[model samples]
Structure formats: C-alpha cells, structure tokens
Target: MTKIIDGKAVAKKVNDQTAEAVTELVAQGVQPGIAVIIVGEDPASQIYVRNKNRKALKLGMHSVVRQLPVTTTQEELLAIIAEYNADRSIHGILVQSPLPKQINEPLITRAIDPKKDVDGFHPENVGKLITNYPGHYPVANTPRGIMTMLKEYNVELAGKTAVVIGRSTIVGKPMAALLTNANATVTLAHSRTRHLKAVAKTADILVVATGITHLINGADIKPGATVIDVGMDRDENGKLTGDVDFDSAQDVAGLITPVPGGVGPMTIATLMQTTVELAKWSDAK
Candidate 1:
C-alpha cells in the first residue's frame, strides 16, 4: 500500500507551532504583524490573501491588507510600499504576485525592506539564499514549508538521489538548492529536457512542479520513490489537480501529497511563520 503524505496534517502542525510562537511573543508584549498588499482583483490572489489574513489573525498576529485599484499608478504603489517599510509595527510585507501591467514587478519587490521582505523576493534576501549565507536564511514560503514537512516526517536526504522537475525561482530552484545542501545528489529537469522519462526514473525523491495538469503519470515515478507535487491546476470539471496524476502515480510512489490538502495549506502556514520570525528579529533591535 502506498503511504499518502498528509500535507493537511503537517500544515496543521506548522499552524499550531505558529500559534504558540504568537502567544509567546504576545506574552512578551510583542505583537507580530504582517502587511499584505494586493493590486487588482485577481480571484486566485484574492483567495490567497483572504486565507493568509484569516490564518494570521487566528494565530494572534496583526493582519493588515492594502487593496489597491487596478488603475493605481506605479508611483502610488511604491509610495504605499514605502509607508509599510517605515512602519515599525509592520514586521512582514508581501505584495501578491501578478501586479497590474503598469507596475514594474521587480521594482516593487526590490522596494520592500530586506528585513521585512518575508516573501524572500528582494535582491538581498535572494542573494543570501543563493550564497547560503550564515544565520537563518529566509526562503520562499512554499519551499520552506516543504522542507519543514520533510523534516517533520524524518525523511533522510544525505547520499540520496533527488530529482526536481521545474526551474521556477519560487519552488524548483530553491528546492534543488535545499536538497543539495543536505548532501543529496540533485538533478533539476525542466520542460526542455530531453529523455525526461529516463531522467525522472533515476531518483529516490521526485518532485513534480511542471504546472501542466497531469504532466506526470505512474511511469514517471520510480517505484517506491517519494513524490512531491507542487503544481496546482484546475481541471475542466473545476476540480483541483496537480502536475502528477495522483491516482496513477500512487501505485508506484512510496509517498505522495494530495492536491488541495497538501502543499496548498502549507504555503500560508509558512508565510505566517516567517511573519512571526520577522517580528521577533525586528523586536530584538
């Protein structure tokens, strides 16, 4: 029988830890706060922001959301970001992705104060991650959460062969870096890779994040390999799906995470955790 990786359960554990951290900080008279900025009304981004706010508030953190109109100019957005940067009480700031076309996305990301850039998209933070800088390096939410889950499960990485399918900065590249740092032999495959099937079969751990629905089937996974599916796609029937065909891959995979209840919940939980960390770090100053 294939072991189903319970991402929901793991995320709940993270949430509980975050809540406890919040309580501890509050007892010390430090209230962690997160500022979430959303430009335009993209439905997916709206849903993500709403969930983040709800979870942050539930964990006793201050959740502030700044909603800007689609017509808002670049200067207006930068001014708002500057305000958040100077606000001593705001520990973390996240400008949701897919900003209006008029806005320069990279410029907005760089404008965030490095210490408060909880999303880890700023050049300073990215540089730290790239260089494996000493101290606690702030990683992107999803990658951090995925690492947390792996640790909680006691999965060994040393001397292991791992394959990551995706090259996106947000998940794939970071994931490969993390795995390699743990002494694992990491192979990163992308859409352009030749003999993809042969490449995927050579792994003790396989992560699928290609974004295309059902891009991976049972044959793509080596038997008894642990699989992590990071892509979230909606099928024509409006059901949430992942890059891997879960039903088929399960027969071969030793462990797997489900679509909706898996990595999805962990992302925000990790974000909240990062927010709390930022608050504590800032409070020490």
Candidate 2:
C-alpha cells in the first residue's frame, strides 16, 4: 500500500509541540509574540495572516497584525518595521510578500532585525542557510515543514538521490540546500532543464513545486520513490490539484502528499513553531 502523508495530522503534532514550548516560555515569565505585517488587502494574504494570528493566540502567544494601505509610503512601512524590531515584546516579525511596486522588497526585507525575521528572507538567514553549517538561523517555512515531514516519515537522505523541481528562492533553493546538508545528492531542476522527466525519474526522493497543474504524473516518477507536491493550483474544471497527478502517481510512489491536506497546513504550522523558537532565542540573549 502506498503510504499517504497526512499533513493535517502532522501539522497538529507540530502545533501541539509548539503549544508545550509556549507554556514553558510563559512559565519562564515570557510570552512569545509575533507581528505579521501585510502591505495590502490581498484576499489570500489576509486569510493567511488571520490563520497565523489565530494559531499563535491559541498557543498562548501574543499575535499582532499590522494592516497597511497599498499606498503606504516606503518610509511609513520601514518606520513601522523599526517599531516592531525594537519592541522587546515582539520576537518574530513577518512582512507579507508582493509589496507594491513603489516599495523596494529587498530594502524592506533588510530593514528587519535578522533575529526577528521569521520569514527567513533576510540575506543573513539566506547566507547562513547556504553555508549548510549548523546554526540557529531561520529558514523558509514550507521547506522547513517538508524537511520535518521527511524526518517524521523516517525517510533516509544520506547517500540518497534527491531531485527538487522548481528554483524559487522561497522553497526550491532552500529545500535543495537542506537535503544536501543532510547528505543527499541534490539536483535542482528548473523550467530550462533538459530531459526534465528523465531527470525526475532518477530520484529516490522527488519534490515538485512548479505552479503548473499536473506537470508531473506517474510516468515521471521512479517506482517506490517518495513524492512531495507543493503546488496548489486549480484544474480546468476548477478543482484543486497539485503539481504531480496524485491519482496516477500514487500507484507508483512509495509515499506521497495530497494537494489540500499535504504541504499546505504544514506551512502555517511551521510559522507557529518558528515563532516560538524566535521567542526562546530572544529570551536566551
């Protein structure tokens, strides 16, 4: 039987553990605090921020969301970030992406204190990640969650051939670094990669994150390979689907993640967990 990876169940376990950690912090006279800043009223961004805030509160942490207008000036945003950065109460700070064109994304990312950058887009964290050394720098949440899933499933990466499809800095680049750091031979495939299917079929562990719906199917997978699909797209009939065709790939995969119930929940769960970690790190200093 193909073992189906249940992300919701895994997310629950992660959140439960985080709740325990939060309790310990509270007992130590500290409450984990996170500030989520969203530049505009993007429906998807609003939904994500609400979920994160709710989860943080449920875990007994302080959660604040700063909703800024789309026309908010760059100086206005930076000043707000500076306020959060200096506030000892806020241990983690995340700025929702897709900022307005007038605002420089990199400039804003660099403005936040690296220690409180829970989103892990800051160059300091990115450099630490690329070094592949042992450190406490935070990483992209989706990749961090996927790595947690691999460990929970007892999937060995040492000496394994791992292939990651997509080269987005948010997920793909960090994911490849993590697997490589764990001793896997990692290959990152992008849109321009030649013989993509042939490259994909050679992996013992395969992760597909290309936004295209149904980009990979059973034929692209090696028999008994572990597959993780990170794409959340809508098919022609408006049904939710992942990058890999689950219906066919499930037959060939040893273990696989589903569209709605797989990697999605883990992302938010990781955000909660990392927020708690940042709180602990701050307390230590």
Best by TM-score: 2
lDDT of 2: 0.93
lDDT against the true structure, each candidate: 0.88, 0.93
- Candidate 1, 30-70: lDDT as tens digits: 88999999999999999989999999999999889999999
Candidate 2 error regions (>4 Å): 283-285
Give the least accurate 10-residue stretch of model 1, judged by summed lDDT. Answer: 129-138
Q: Write the per-residue lDDT of candidate 2 for residues 1-285, one digit (tens) a residue.
A: 789999999999999999999999999988999999999888978998898899899989999999999999999999999999999899999999889888999999999999999988898898899897476878989999999999999999999999999998789999999999899999999999999999999999999999989899999999999999999999999988999999999999999999999999999999989989998988443
Off by over 4 Å in 1: 283-285
TM-score of 1: 0.97
